[model samples]
Target: MMKILLIVFNWVGKGTYWRALKFAEHLCRRGREVTLLATSQHNRIGIEERIINQVRLVETPDLFTGSLRSGWDMWNVCNRIAWLRNHDFDIVHVFEARPVALFPALYMQRIKHISLVMDWADWFGKGGSVEERPNPIIRNILRPVETFFEEHFRTWADGTTVICTTLQQKATELGVPPNTIVMLPNGCDTERFEVIPHQIARRRLHFPHDMLIIGYMGSIFQHDAELMACAFDIICQQIADVRLLVIGYCPIDIRQLVKKPQYVIQTGFIEDEYLNNHLASCDVCWLPFKNTNANKGRWPLKLNDYMAVGRPTIATAVGDVVSLFETEPIGLLAEDNPMSFAEKSMQLLHDSTLRLEMGTHARHVAETRFSWADLTRRLEDLYQYILKTGTK
Candidate 1:
């Protein structure tokens, strides 16, 4: 069995962390010995305990607050390198391409090391030269540091894996060899999101059975609030039975839009169980992304989650979403305008046969292409290739 060491900054409540966990779990189940090194700042001890095989947690002290900033983040790379010099491992996989981690990964490669680089930052426009909205002095001060980490990490990694083709192109533009980059898209835990009876789920949530519910799940990022509010306002005006179910945290200004009881149902920052329950009850899942530079490379995780539960998705044609869904016979891709979103959503709501058919097709696509099991297999193949050839 090959021994693998996986290095990441921290494991908090994020999509990247979940993907890393699933990847580790899958590799371990395949009889590969794996060790995960993560920061202890986020109280991830519980997360460590859930894994099936050998694992270790290195608790580094938080330097700034002695509570949040893991001072050892920079030292973590050197320490891991020093430890690895004495230890033996077949491969080192770095999830986030930060300088602190890259220095160690590069060092490992210099000794003829084998590894896989999972790049998420490049896709989100973090390394690009695109102009961002002007921010306060603090943000400006920290911007350079963020850029340095992103740029260095991309240049140093041996074999790079990106979430979307847009990101892979960005990596090539940034000097990474075209052949070194591979697409390892985000995937959903389909079995966890198996279709449940819609009316039963609605009744469990105490949602009105008569109302036509449209839902949005996951974190509300930049400009999401304004776009969702504008779309919902237009949707409510046209369809009397239409109700919006928002399952995550919303900004204060956006939450105020739900004041009118007839239009909105805001379940502020729901737990995973409740969020899944509400999703199972939804008539349509909304993914309203703003047409910003950062959004251009996005492959929303919610898209797969929505599809897994057999819910019809209505989203903006931002990033690679059009390519992913337009080919599928399941969902609708609307323009980024409120009127367009409202019109498309209403059309889906009015046609029950179409909704059911689309939902079934969406679930089929997710099961065949987007399941975590299938995704892990792709990662495993990448890992095996790195081990055999030491480079892509």
Candidate 2:
């Protein structure tokens, strides 16, 4: 039987943590013994363990819950590494390259003689997401540290998984073996969400049946949020019955930026059970991203949320999203401007038949291409390659 250890730098909240859990759960059902190591959400000083859907979840305490990155707890890594020495795993998959994430993963590779695969799901250094930081001084300080962690450790991996072609190109440019680098976007958890009728969902959520709902899911970075706010303002100028459904946690109150605060409905972070209900309430979903390195380097988890509920998206033409639009008529892509975005949105709003068609296509692609079952095959294939050939 294959044994796999999955290590995440943070608690079970962010996109990366969810990705690790989903992959671990999928692997466990396939008869692979999988263990997931993550930081506990609370600042407790104790470690905890449990079995969730047949996968062992080990959460180590992290103190810095207030920091932007969070989970700078090297204590857990040290203690876990010391304890992990007694266990044997065929593969160790590390998500991201932070102090807490990298240290234990490197220990598994170097000290325990286990095969290591590093996953790069975001571009966080220098010209990427660092540009999104509000403070210039903080950005300048983090440039070197972020680069060192994000770029310096790729060669240590036996294999690598990237979320987009842009990051895959960056990894290969950094001299990671091209064959070892697989472009694996975050898979849609189709099993978790069922397609609900848009009107029925709106009624369930107590939203007005007359309003044309445009939903945006999850927290967004600052740059994208500004662009989204601008686009929404423009959208209101043309449509009267429109409303913005801001589902989950957003850094800023979207109502503050828009022309009409009354039209914006902000449902702060709700549970997983109500996720589909919230998402399905939208007539159209928003994916307003500017054409930048930051947007290109990462796949938005909200895109998966939009797909799960079978809602057509009004996205700006950028990076891998453009590749997605080309492959399937899942949604319409607009230029990175308010006028263009508002225009494409108007086009979708007016045509109900086209919107429904695109929504069905979005749902189909999510089920077939981006489902966890299908994506797990690619991951397992990479594992098979490493196991058969011996780790690099």
Candidate 3:
């Protein structure tokens, strides 16, 4: 049996947590022994550990009690490394690059002859809260150290997987061989996100029967939520009974812009348990992103959920959206502006037949291209190849 260890940097129930959990679960279903290593609060650590579908999760506890940011992060890294020393794994797959924790794992890999694979999902040192506002002196001091470890690991790893072509390009630019990089986009559970009766879902959510609902998922900061609100407001003027449904946390600034609070409904932070049902209630999904370098590298996870539920998406022509949806008629691709977005959304809203056709195309794409089964098969291939070659 192949034993694989997946290391996630944080223990949040969203983003990396969901990705790690889904991958671990699917990999386990393929008859591989998978253990997910994550970090949580001292009281919560190890308490949630359980074998679910043959995947074991072991969360290390933070050493400190309070939320002293730097101290908590440093201690968490040390704790994870200490826990890793006692375990045995044939393969170690790390989701993000953090030198403090990863360096210790690398040392173990060298001594233990364990294979290492690194995954790149987004841009480093850009747009996160810590990176957004940092002490310049510290940032400058750590820049070289961060770069040294990142490049060293990328060059040393047996194999690498990236979320998009843009990141693959970045890896090549940084001296990683093109052959070593596999482009793996985000995917969804097609079985879980299947089409539900529109009225049935709406009735459950208490949505109006005759309303045209446009929805957006994920955290508010990921995309231009204010622009989405602006686009929805414009759509409302052209079509009566148009409603905006936000399934995740909405920022206070974005919340302040909505003119008709009654027409716009925000279900802040929908848990994974109720995500599918809430997503199925939408008539259309929006992916409104401001054109930025970081945004270009992102292949939004919500795209999969939208496609999985057979809903048409009106998205900006950025990142993988152009390659994924522009050529095919699965979704409408518009320029990154409010007017263009509103126009394309209104197009979908005006024609029920077009929306239905697009939705069907979206689901077909999901089944063929973005299903978790397909993704796991591809990863299995990569794993076999890496084990055979010893390095790629």
TM-score of each: 0.85, 0.97, 0.89
Model 3 pairs whose backbones collide: none
Better of 2 and 3 by lDDT: 2
- Candidate 2: worst 10 consecutive residues by lDDT? 63-72
Between candidates 1 and 2, the TM-score winner: 2
Model 2: how far is 45 from its true place, Å? Answer: 0.8
Candidate with the greatest lDDT versus the true structure: 2
Residue-level lDDT of model 1, residues 77-179, one tens digit each, is: 5555665576567777776665444565667677845565655533322433222434556456646766666665676666677877777787788888877
Ranking by lDDT: 2, 3, 1
Could you tell me which 10 consecutive residues in candidate 3 have the lowest summed lDDT? 125-134
After TM-score superposition, the amount by which residue 71's alpha carbon in candidate 2 deviates from its true location, in angstroms, is: 4.2
Taking the tens digit of each residue's C-alpha lDDT, what string does model 3 give over 123-213? Answer: 6543322232236776666556555554567877887889888778878987887877788888866866878867889998788889989
Best by TM-score: 2
Pairs with backbone N, CA or C atoms under 3 Å apart (clashes), candidate 1? none
lDDT of each: 0.69, 0.87, 0.75
Q: Write the per-residue lDDT of candidate 2 for residues 1-392, one digit (tens) a residue.
A: 99999998878777699889999999988899999988877745777888999999888776566334353567767766765777789999999898888898899899888899999988888788888889999899988888899999999899999999999999999999988988889888888888999888978979889989999988777777778888888888888999999998777788888778998999897987888988998999999898989999999988987897898999999889998998899899999988898889999999999999999989998898898887888999999999898865
Error of 3 at 115 (Å): 1.2
Q: At residue 157, what lDDT does model 3 achieve?
A: 81
